[model samples]
Target: MIRAVLFDLDDTLLRLNLTAFIARYVAGASRLLASVARTTPVALGVPYVRAFLAMDAQDREDSLTNEQLFNKTMLEACGIPLDDPVIADLMTYYEERIVPGFSSGVVAARPVPGAREAIEAVHDAGLICALATNPTFSLACDRARMGWAGVDEKDFALVSTYSNSTRCKPSTRYYQEFANQLGVRLEECLMVGNDAVRDIVRDGCGLRTAYVGHGRPRGAVWRGPMERLARELPDLVARLDEQDA
Candidate 1:
């Protein structure tokens, strides 16, 4: 019997043009850091950004954390020797300025039409709701994204952020941890998100899974509308209700 629903944030509950957000943030951060760094904005900034992204891509593929890969990639990309004072300053700048500035763009998130209604229906049924976003960001960052997606922090029984989780999505360990936190059996949870590879695959961990379908990346199977999502939950609940009976 399903007792919990977990939702992925970006491109799932919230629609985002990742390329646009990244470009705008990089440009803004580069300019902001230029005067202080005493270098051409792109010269210092773009390489660091590229390095960061590279590290992220590598981390996703290798199951490493962002911090584990960031500094080494940055040092290698900049060729500035690992212990350079400039590298230290750049890291400081990124953490202090760039991350927060980029996060500000998330405030522009608009809910996928009907997503709020679907979530409301699930909540009304007395099932637990969770925001199971990849735990690579702070709670403040997750809250900002949730605000953009039209989900309040209050809506979730559990909100998984990097500060609060030791693992990330696509890892069954993370899903299990979330289930444990919510006091729900893995088989009694539904993992809902846009990514088939990350979200739907959580079914392997014993959770029922729903692919959000909209906003799928290239070559992904399309599911359908948010209203269909809303419509489908009752059937799932009915099945679980029968199992309980």
Candidate 2:
């Protein structure tokens, strides 16, 4: 019976052009870290990008926290040995500059039209709300983006982050952990996101799911834009409840 609704943040609640955000952030990050390195930002960009990719790859397998894995890989990519003082500086740049910069300055984000109303619809239906964002970034990063998207953090019962989650999106374990955290079965929760493959791990995770756009549900739970979701969710929730009963 639709006890919870987990919403994806990027491209769903907020419109963040991933390519654009990445370019801006990489530039900002290089400059931020270059103070410690006596080299060109472009050279730093190469390994910075590589390390981030490595972290994403590691996120799926190891139980290491995202910060732990990122620290190890980034230090290795930079040719800095563990326990080097420079590792501290890199981490400082990440925590103090990189992630926060995305929200206010490094990248521009826009709220998805009607997302707030859709969230409200979910609430009115007496379902719990959660942010099932990919666990690649810290909670602060997701919270900042959520603020721009007009989603109040206070409203969510669970918000996934790198420190809290072991797996990233597209992995069934990610959704499984999310539902486990909420203490609900997959069928009792509905996941809504823009990315078809990453958000709805239906065949893998067996969770009810929804997509946003012209894309049909296509073995998903629901499909429509935010405006339509705002209108459809309450009725849909009622129908699901009846079916479950």
Candidate 3:
């Protein structure tokens, strides 16, 4: 019984050449931070990368928001103090420039085939939807990526961001938290994405799931490309609806 659909942003709904995007993003982001903070570019860049990776780490010691953890960890790695304005400036740049620029030249995002229609199909069937991208990014970044996927920001019921999500993917709590947000039981939702390791791990949180292609699915109900999802989802959703009833 799937009352909601959780869609992963990158690679699932939008097509991204990961290597090319990361190379450009790191370069551009480092440059932008250097210009704004007027710091040693290489020094700032290393901590930036490390901090982002650290956020993705599954060690659940504390429940600090991603901003607090990133700021604290990044400042320590950069040999800066708690009161430094550079950290503040870096966050501002992230929200204002980073993602907008990513969607522009650094990594031009394009929609995966049949993505918009599939989402629309879910909505047409009276199911709920959310953007379940890993919350290590700012909302602006998610919105920009959504644009490339041909999805309007208004379409999602919830957009997960580091500001709100306490755990990263592969953590069952991450899936649980999103289900809680929708005021629905986890067993009544479907996590739909391409990342076999991360997105499909949502099943551990008690939700049903469908695996989009390029990911080796373990026990997902649907396994294929976005085009396949578009074709099969109407029937699949109906099955779930009837089964739940």
Candidate 4:
């Protein structure tokens, strides 16, 4: 029997286009950095962008935390020696200015049409719910996104953020940590999200999964039409109940 439901934030419960958010975030960071670095936004941004992309690529194969990879890549891209004071300053600026701006914007998040109702339904069914987004962001940022998604912080039994987790998603360690925190066996949890690679495929860790159909291109074990996703929550719950019998 499923005792809990875990969700992905972006493009699942929330309707914000993540790719667009990233582009806007990068642009904001570049503009902010340029103001202090005495360089054009694009000029300063180019290296950072290249480094960021490189770090993302490395993340696929490397076990380093996202922050670690980001710092190392930023230093390398800026041609600054590791542990340089300037690098520290730049990192501080990025976190203080750029990161906060991104969070603020997320506070204005849009919820999927039936997301709120679905979550309420889950709660009413006596099941626990949590947000299991990839742990690359801080809790504050995650909260901001939740706010945008029309979900209250109290709605989740646990909210996994980078600060709360040591492993990123698609990694069984990450899902395991969440399962541990909630005091639930993996078999009793259901993960619902839009990313196939990160969310659904995590079934290897033992949680059942439901694929929300609107995000990155990926094959889902089960695909439901986007418009029907929220509307079908009741039916989904019924199916789960029947399966558990």
- Compare the candidates by lDDT and give the number of the best one: 3
Against the true structure, candidate 2 reaches a TM-score of: 0.84
Q: Quickly count the clashes in candidate 4.
A: 1
Higher-scoring candidate on TM-score, 1 or 2? 2
lDDT of 4 by residue, 150-236 (tens): 888799899987556656777777788889999998878878887777786533555777787655444343466445655666677
- In order, the Cα lDDT scores of the candidates are 0.67, 0.76, 0.77, 0.69
Model 3 lowest lDDT segment of ten: 79-88
The 10 consecutive residues of candidate 1 with the worst lDDT sum are: 214-223
lDDT tens digits by residue: candidate 2, 1-245: 77999999888888877677767767866776665666667777777676567656724567776656665776777754424677565755575555655655435688999899988888887889999988876676676678778887898999998777766777777788889999998888888898877877756445777788556757676778888988999887778779779
Deviation of model 3 at 81, angstroms: 7.4
Q: Sort by lDDT, best first: what order? A: 3, 2, 4, 1
lDDT of 2: 0.76
Q: Candidate 2 regions off by >4 Å?
A: 58-60, 80-108
Worst 10 residues of 2 by lDDT: 80-89
TM-score per candidate, chains pooled: 0.69, 0.84, 0.88, 0.71
Candidate 1 error regions (>4 Å): 26-108, 214-223, 240-245
What is the overall TM-score of model 3 with all chains considered together?
Answer: 0.88
Residue-by-residue lDDT tens digits, candidate 1, 45-89: 657676556543513554444444544565565544424577546
- Model 4 ranges with Cα > 4 A deviation: 36-40, 43-64, 79-109, 214-245
